[model samples]
Target: MKWLGVLLAVAVAVIVIYKVNYPSYSYRYRLQVSIAVDEKIYTGSSVIEVVWDCGPKIAGLGRCAPSLGGPATLIDLGAHGVIVATLRSGENISPTPDGAIDAVWLCASAFGYRSTNEELPALPHLTGRRNLSVSNLPRLVWFVNPADMKSAQKVTFLNVASVFDPTAHFTEAFVEITRDPIVVDIPNKLPWFSELRRLQKEGKGTLSKSGQFQLVYNMFVGENS
Candidate 1:
């Protein structure tokens, strides 16, 4: 009986240790986006899942941090009227003496037209040093009495910086982040997965010539130890 009790104690300890070292957590986002162009409003929604696990860490180097268990689920809003939506994910690494911080980000863009036959306007050239990075480009644009689809008329642009700017006074659009549980495998069954995979293969370096609206979402995850 004493030997049996000892065995039970050892089993419990091993389970606890495994749980601590291999912990997993995930966050799910349901994004709904609406864009108004001319007299029409276009809308779309997407579900994104991100999972992390507290993997092994080197001793005396840094704290134990979670690593992505697998590739994050991508977002594809599909075609809403003449507007087509696209999303892609990537990581940015910032190194430290002891470790490195990984910033995983998602970039969202949309292409729109008055009609399928109408040629979409070219994306405006980003001016000034602050606009150099693709991440810095505007997510939403408000056109005011455009002369034509191809005309480079004056328009309002909204990016991450401008959204937080006190003077920008952006009231029409907003981005939200929250902690919510999700089924990790749900994205695989989604109808848009094939198309989203194609976009992911294309990567962020290439911009769609037909793209007009762009937005970026960033989340900081594990540190390499």
Candidate 2:
């Protein structure tokens, strides 16, 4: 009888904490990242947990957590383009108020279309395995949805090259979707690598150098209860 009472109390506490702390709506996004370098391909994956925050339903909504600095980074939710969240990366890099996300996606697209009408070299491409012709960067747009809490999401520096500085190297990239995040180790010859090797041997793909490529893919699992 005593043990049953204790179990019930603990269960109630857990529910309360989750309700208060976790976002009203949340989803787990699994991202598989990979790259093509020097005719070889290497890959890895990261899990992005996202939360949405819906501020007061009013026009010209005021900023959240002003003392923390300025307004949190905001992105447009896909459907209505509803603005959401003060975005931050898993590394705690706070999102900038500027439209950096849009800019990065833009630059990630076609290159050499200049403001001055001069010909320039094109930018590297981010391809989708299922749809290779167009850039796969749009897959990342889901992050803009608002959540009450921040997701532990990570986007590698290489992909962020468009928005961030120190631009260098041309690389072909793709994302292989997954239900959950995977830990890819190079030395152990994991299952993922086995497939990579098979692809390479069959002339379907190239082997990636260690730490050369980052694989990221995502699936929208059901919302939090």
Candidate 3:
């Protein structure tokens, strides 16, 4: 009986040690987004590269790729398509298209004061934080329950109709500040996929509900929307 009690104590001690050490062994990531573009469902490995500096102390920092969840779009802004009975060529100069990153990136990019050395071809200064600012809050951060994709049926896109005062300035140095595609890989049975059904019925486009969601938000922020 004494031996049994000793063994039990040892087992309990081991369990306690494990419980205390588990967090140390695990990775504590910085970013997580329930929203992902490209209609991708969220999985364990979804990631997006983001900038992390606005001023000097925060200058040239790259945020770790973030984890993401489902149902967004891959926006090809210059995508050649038939629009309003015309072969419309997408805009070139002083132009901003519509779409979103994983929700976390969007929130940080718009709301968080940060930037990176990451530069795009057309807009090399895309990460310039000296003048970047988020003038308003959109639907990204509100009630972000992983299981609520249903109520989020329709997605919208808004373009910045005009290029005016920039919170930051991108040097016109052959940089392309194009938005990257937000991608996440999730299993078929993630939380809240039922929301997609309602999205399909109410979405603005037939392509996919998440696709519409990306576009609609981009449009709502038209030019800057």
Candidate 4:
């Protein structure tokens, strides 16, 4: 019995060692979107890349990645009359003609923030920060529940149309700032939050009942939306 117990302990230790030594590989990601506008469905994909300051290694991991340099089009609300779009990370089911990263990079390049490349490029100057000037409420944070591909999430953008300010400047003069996506929360604080609820109640605004979802709000003070 003593010998058997020792063998079991040894086996367990070996398993633990093997599991700990195994490394997790990270890959660049791509996003696909399926937009539902009334009866018409439109689709596109975009390659999303994070510029790591260093290669994948413990010494390099401490380096920070840049945020998006400016407001880029994630989707064209006007061109396709996009109402609601389903976004997933891949190219299998939908095409990726309309990509957020592409738009951001292009605009960033035009402003001379970073030079563009044919393949996976890095925007070294872009850094992520919460812009309090845009909204007092923090942006939405999310992760999957049950960790299954089948689970889907629904989010609404309050005053999605009004978030963007037309006249905004992008420069390397100050640190290039890229805004994160916002999600709505309770105890409505911003004036826009009240306006959104009032419009929803009054049956006004571009967003309609058919398009209603639990709203998510992220406001970049100068983003194009």
Q: After superposition, how far is residue 114 of candidate 2 from its true place, in Å?
A: 28
What is the Cα-based TM-score of model 4?
Answer: 0.23
**Clashing pairs counted in every model:** 1, 20, 48, 14
Residues 1-225, model 3: lDDT tens digits: 999999999999998765443311101112222222233322121223332222222334322232222222221112111001000111122121332233323434442423222321112233422222233112221112333333323222122111211221211111112344433322132243234333444763322233333212222111110
| lDDT scores of the candidates, listed in order | 0.30, 0.29, 0.27, 0.29
- Which pairs clash in the backbone of model 1? 139-214
lDDT of 4 by residue, 74-189 (tens): 33334322222222211222223222122223324433444323122334344442211221111211112212212223232333223222221111111124333322222121
Error at 44, model 1, angstroms: 1.9
Output the better candidate (1/3) by lDDT: 1
Task: Report the C-alpha lDDT of model 2 over 1-225, residue by residue, as the tens digit.
Answer: 999999999999998776554313322333333333334444433433333333332455421110111112222223312121111211112242222221222222223222111111122122222322233232232122223112213333345334212332224332222245423232131123345445544666432223222121111111111
Error of 4 at 157 (Å): 6.7
Best by lDDT: 1
Q: How do the candidates rank by TM-score, highest first?
A: 1, 2, 4, 3
Comparing 2 with 4 on TM-score, the higher-scoring candidate is 2
For candidate 1, what is the lDDT?
0.30
